[model samples]
Target chain A: MARYATTPSQTVGPYLHIGLPWPDGPFAVAEGTPEGVWIRGVLYDGAGAPVPDGLIETWQADPEGRFDHPDDPRGAVARPGFRAFGRCPTDANGEYGIFTLKPGPVPGPGGTLQAPHIDVSVFARGMLHRTVTRVYFPEEAAANAADPVLSSVPEPERATLVARPAEDGYRFDIRLQGEDETVFFDV
Target chain B: MSTDPTTRPAPPAYARDAEVHPPLDYPGYRSTALRHPKRGLRLLPHLLTEVTGPLLGEDRISENDSDLTRQHDGEPQGQRIIVHGQVRDGDGRPVPHTLVEIWQANAGGRYRHTGDNWPCPLDPNFSGVGRTLTDDQGRYRFTTIRPGAYPWRNHDNAWRPAHIHFSLFGRAFTQRLVTQMYFPGDPLFFQDPMWNSIPDEKARERLVARFDYANTAPEWALAYEWDIVLRGREATVFEDEVDED
Candidate 1:
């Protein structure tokens, strides 16, 4: 009788070592006295567990929605005490915080004062891909309600993106998945 | 559990050739490193040194490094900053089981610790070092106080722009990458030494993120998003084994 046989499975070797340099250290950036509004929050997994050792990066316009760099043709306008960009990592408890001034209304791609918000990107191990989420301020309800981006999301999920007021400043929690998921975007 | 008479054990496919080729076993093939419990995690330190070696030329110690372990001083309030992004493969597929590491300055243009002495006091609660492994979908996030723009010795009266340094590893050394992300509205982008260090314009733009107000929270919080891609699915071809002679 004819019979079929399966070939032996090939053993998988360890991939080349790819690790971060200065693994246990703080990010490098300009040192200035911080000013402006601040937002603080934690990053959690689908199971609602804090992800320690995660990295968080943010970039935004100044209080006047103007960029602080010279490449920006708008020229550097004096927004006294407005620092535009920042970066930080989650603590052992999966908590991260940022302190910046309240961004001003900037002209959007369509010439609109995009709502005051900060752009965010999250990176961690075990993730085959990264997830992107945004943080909004609770006080900017009027602006947020009218924001072009917020308008895109369904009404029920809108609250997930806004930062509620905390004693120190504002606080927002981002969940990678599951219930109460923070609003993540494609871009 | 009665066995059917019709079913019978199958014969070995290579039984006829077994006499010509003696039975072979993969004995003594194990490496000693696997036996150590700490060996797995210990790989990080070596990996970090290789990834960060190139960017060392621009390294400058932050003023806050000295005080990082101390309590937050009431001196000057710092700005708040957030950094978030996704880890994807070359095909934009999420890659899980990868490690990410980040280090940056504090709100005062100072770092938590790097052996640099600046005037800014470190926040006791803020230790700038953070690490995370990607989830099943290849996503990661970090929240921390905004880093301030600090002056450096790169140029006369030169100050670095507010930026976050990012380092990522994607399954292998060939897929490893290290780059810095910049804020959209920083004026110093022009005068900054490191930003100009990158020669390619399109490559340089990769470091900048778009402003998505939808990601933004209230005045107390802000949001940004970034996605990273890694090469994948390549064949491994070996020419020949080295000859002992």
Candidate 2:
């Protein structure tokens, strides 16, 4: 079959905040929902400067490992108030936050099980294309160890994908360049 | 052990084509030098999490969200234009109900952002932000003013070609794309490093929107048509195939 080539990606430029952010953007679940934790972090450039113009988006399953998408083989999510996606732009100080419930384990390829993680896409002024990454929970040590994606990453660099435990949730800082750069995926 | 006949295997992941996408380390865009990752990206397996994406319901978009000209009391200043396009998959199937977002400079090439202080007057009525959901036919339209060329510090007297920034989310997470749309036959293409970064001349032309005289409203606004094609899921997923390194 002759398929059409997908359009190329371009930088989000410095003015992304004008269009990307949503009023209820950071909240994957409704505000003040019990057990909802905030995933917070700061985006940094190679020079160690904060990136205030960046945007971060997250996609995750519900606590039961079910998605709200039709592509999920297990079935569509029926939860009334849960929003599986979140879009948050960095503040002036280069900080971003997402309020949501932690996701459970999801199905992986080759009959393996993926650890609790949130799929993230990073868009910034300098990035020609959105960088794909993941946020893993620190508490899921066992599951993280057995994850196929984590296993594929070099042993020393795997820590960049795991979030640190914070007051109400986890903190996963993203570094676009320099040492300890976040593990970007080629998916 | 028997496999369930009713449950079809999930679709394979869409691999990003390097030839079409600009490199992160393109020196033409100076900001990329310090911002691009020094290391290569790791490969991720297509799983339930990757294939499934958030379906942004229609509720998020309110009335007049698609019409930037009607947001304020008075009309925005500039030549009014109607930008319309269709979102499709690699297989040429319409991707219906997807979200399309756009932000651009006002007719004067001045952005509404606080960071943009290039000595240009800001339009109080034009915010330069608009979003809409594609219809059942995968088509989306926006009513707005045509933006002007803007000066940038990339080079000596570098003025960016008039363009509109676009952000799109296809059905799946892997199908996310962000790009810019240009007018057909802009004289500024020769000096714009961002536009020149694309190695392929033909691929670069895809970013230009065609002037649609047929769709132009009699006196209200001129029309420009462009279509966005996104990576589609493979027809048959090979579960056991190893990724070629």
Candidate 2 TM-score restricted to chain A: 0.97
Query: Which segments of candidate 1 are over 4 A away from where they belong?
Result: A1-35, A70-73, A76-83, B1-245
lDDT of 1 by residue, B1-245 (tens): 21521122111111111111111122122221121111011111111111111112112223333232232454324654455677775444675756665566767777654444668776656655555666778887665556677875545677767666555655432244445556777888787534444444454455676555676657854666766655432222332344333
lDDT of 2 by residue, A43-124 (tens): 9999989998899999998998888888876668768778988899998889999999999888776667789899999999
lDDT of 1 at B138: 82
What overall lDDT goes with each candidate model? 0.49, 0.88
True contacts kept of each: 0.00, 0.69
Q: Which stretches of candidate 2 lie over 4 Å from their true place?
A: B1-9, B235-245
**Cα error, candidate 1, residue B13 (Å):** 60
Q: Go through the candidates in order and give each one's DockQ.
A: 0.01, 0.63
RMSD of 2: 3.5
